[model samples]
Target: MAYWLFKTEPDAFSIDDLQQAPQQSTFWEGIRNYQARNFLRDDVQVGDQVFIYHSSCKIPAVVGIATVTKGAETDPHQFDLSSDYYDAKSSKDNPRWVGVTLCYQQHMPRPVTLKAIKADDAITELALKKAGRLSIMPVTDAEWTHICQLGGTE
Candidate 1:
């Protein structure tokens, strides 16, 4: 199965939030970036594994694992005038955003901090290391395994 890294700001929606959600799952939404949206709409799929990374935190890290329990679907918020993520230009006939449902798998045995990841030359190709700002991105098998190992989850 494909692997991915999904970044979220802890204060806004932490791993704990997902764990506490009904069925330990939530619909991933509010993605406004086209590139990230494309990944969700095209590349990501049901059964895909994900590394839930905590960004914009004191110690940004991959704190947990998730599984894509549902494939991509139109993001309903994009059509809601009251929603902050609404796109006025978008219409029901031609939507501009999409999201997927992810189920909480497990917390990492230990967090794999960005600092620790950046220090490993073997994982230098990671988007986080390459200065990527996208909230959602793909991850290679090797990178996933290495990071999981470092996090004591392998």
Candidate 2:
């Protein structure tokens, strides 16, 4: 199975929120970026692993693990006029946005802080390290294992 990293604002939706959801699963949506949308739609799939990272916070970190319980599908919100993620140019027959469903796997013993990630050379090739912003991004098996071990969840 492939690995991925999904970022969100902790205050908006923390790992605890996902853990407490019904069936401990939630649809990953509201992605407006085209590149991220493409990954969510075409690359991500059911049974793949995920690192639920808390971004836009005091100390950004990977706080938990999740599993993609559902594969890519049209994001219903893109069709709802009232939704902040609505795309007026998008149609039901030709959706411009897509997402997947993630189920809570387990929380890390302690968050693997961005600082910690940066401090390690082994994971420097990670997209999170080389790229500035990406809501959803791929992760190599080595990177995933290293991070999980560092976070005490391996």
Candidate 3:
């Protein structure tokens, strides 16, 4: 199965929030970037594993694991005028934004901090390092294994 890294600001949607959600599933929405949107639309699928990364916060890190429980579908937020992610150009007939639903799998005993990840030799070439800011990015199998090991789950 393909692996991916999905970033969310802790304040906006933390690992705790996912654990607290009904059925522990939530639509990963508000992505406005075309490349990020395309990852959800074209590459992601049910059963894919993802590293739930906390970004834009102190000690940004991979805090938990998630599974893609549902594949790409039009983001409902795009049509809601009151939502921060609303887009006037998008519609039910033709949607410009897309998202997937991720179900919380488990939280690591300890978050694998970015600082710790950066110090690891095996993950030096990881996309999370080289690409840095892309909210949605592919995670190579090796990188996945390495990070899972770091999280004490492998």
Candidate 4:
């Protein structure tokens, strides 16, 4: 299976929230960016491994792991009137956004900080290093293994 990294502002939704979620699973939603949306719609799929990254925090890091339990589907929030992620442009027959469901895998023994990632020579080609603002991004197999090792989760 492929590997991916999904970022979120910890204050809005942290790794702890995922751990506490019922069944330790949650639907990944509200992605408005087209590129990130495309990743969900086209690439992300069930059984894929994902790194839960905490961004916009004091010590940004990859805090935990998750397994994609569901594949891409129309984001239900786009049709919800009261939801903050509601989109008037999307229709039921032709949805504009897509999302996936991920189940919490395990917390890292040592969080791999962004600073540490950037400083590592082995992971110099990691997508997270180049992905400045994209919330969802792909991670190569080698990069994934290396990062997992770094976090003491391998």
Best by lDDT: 1
Per-candidate Cα RMSD to the true structure, in Å, reads 0.8, 0.8, 1.1, 1.1
Identify the runs in model 1 with alpha carbons over 4 angstroms from their true place. Answer: none
Model 2 lDDT tens row, 16-114: 999999999999989999999989888998999999999999999999999999998889999998998889999988889998999999999989999
**What is the TM-score ranking, best to worst?**
1, 2, 4, 3
**Per-residue lDDT value at 95 in model 3:** 92
Give the runs in model 4 whose Cα sits over 4 Å from its true position. none
Candidate 2, superposed: residue stretches over 4 Å from native? none
lDDT of 3 by residue, 1-154 (tens): 8999999999999989999999999999999999999999999999999999999998899999999999998999999999999999998999999999999999987789988888888886667787687899998899898889888886
Model 4 lDDT vs. the true structure?
0.93
Ten-residue region with minimum lDDT total, candidate 2: 123-132
Give the alpha carbon lDDT tens digit for every residue of 1-154 in model 1: 9999999999999999999999999999999999999999999999999999999989999999999999999999999999989999999999999999999999999999998888899996689888759999899999999999998987
lDDT of each: 0.94, 0.92, 0.92, 0.93
Candidate ranking (lDDT, best to worst): 1, 4, 2, 3
Local accuracy of candidate 4 as per-residue lDDT tens digits, 1-154: 9999999899999999999999999999999999999999988989999999999999999999999999998899999999999999999999999989999999999999999999888886667787668989999899999999999988
Residue pairs with colliding backbones in model 4 are none
How do all models score by TM-score?
0.97, 0.97, 0.95, 0.96
Q: How far out, in Å, is residue 30 in model 2?
A: 0.6
Name model 3 segments beyond 4 Å from true. Answer: none
